[model samples]
Target: MSQTLDMFATDDYPALTAGVDEVGRGPLCGDVVAAAVILDPNRPIMGLNDSKKLTEKRRERLFDEIQQNALAFCIARASVAEIDELNILHASMLAMSRAVDGLQRAGESVKPEFVLVDGNRLPKWHYPSEAVVKGDSKVPAIAAASILAKVCRDREMCELDKKYPGYGLAGHKGYPTKVHLEALKTLGVTDIHRRSYGPVKALL
Candidate 1:
């Protein structure tokens, strides 16, 4: 195991340290989703890595494993309206805060003493947290959070595909791909499209 992963497995960290991660920040449509996960030390999940590095099948499988094995987990999001109102960075922070807050509210497990968040920036919240540049890859808890957040958001995008159609949301998950851009140009923007985004703003 790598140094970081090894540290997590050892007793060097807090007993109740939650891992935080977010997804869909780059998507031009759909909400930015975030997840907070407190993994059980006794229930070690193998193959935990950055969600992007894993296949969809792997992520989906891990998503279930994390939810079933973790002491507590919560998924949260900032909607398109919130994203436009707060801007992506602040909106992403809001989503992350919500995820952590939701876990705290669940009251199913002991409160987290520390938080480990992916990315260099921490949300404007009261939680004692440190951001690791690639925490999702280095920390198993963060990796599990990444998987849950990604799977939840991807499923949402697939549902949006059924509702919106022609946008290829299921395929691209609202990223500004060639197909998405073409659909935007032809079909114009939907209510779900983030108007503050460059492509959507241009169309507007």
Candidate 2:
């Protein structure tokens, strides 16, 4: 199967810049997570695909490698309350913006000439950006960003799981799985749950 995504590979752009991605946009609870990664084009990591395609263990391993090897990177998030107020789409864009902002604050030399973001929707940022479909699978930096965002969101869900035991957040990571929906039905919605989401809102 041809897994390559043409969006990132076809364009002969400037020097390899930063890639950004986010997770937890569809979750019933927790904040939107975003990561910005600037990779060394000369020393690219092998087997860099979408984080969703890799096992949790493999993704975790790659997470460390990406961190150690990346030229510059940053992970950022927008809270659940912020999502509720701005809506998930805008909140995710905001998180992506923050991640870029953080990278700029870290150092001027590390700033990106262009930002490659995963997914088709363009982020509402002033920076020069491109939105690529299936970018995480095609672009190494985007894939690294996906892994970082996923792991960070998973860690947050695990913490939430401890505070709210019955929800099984650690298992589903706030996704609307059958068990998660059942938990909502049985235990009622928690403060962390997104009241605007259809599945959780129906119960409310």
User: Best candidate per TM-score, number?
Assistant: 1
The digit string of per-residue lDDT tens for model 2 on 40-148 reads 7666677677888988998888889888878888999998889989999999999998888777433553668888898999877777888888888888788889999
Clashing residue pairs found in predicted model 1: none
TM-score per model over all chains: 0.94, 0.90
Alpha-carbon lDDT, every model? 0.89, 0.85
Highest-lDDT candidate: 1
Q: On residues 1-204, what C-alpha lDDT tens digit does candidate 1 reach at each position? A: 235555444256787889999999898999999999998878888888899988999989999998888988899999999999999999999999888888843456446778899999999888788898888888888988999999999999999999999999999999999999999999999999999999999999
CA deviation > 4 Å runs, candidate 2 = 1-7, 104-109
Candidate 1: segments with Cα more than 4 A from true spot: 1-4, 7-10, 104-110
- Give residue 145's lDDT in candidate 2 (0 to 100): 94
**Position 190, candidate 2: lDDT:** 92
- Cα error, residue 125 of model 1, in Å, equals 1.5
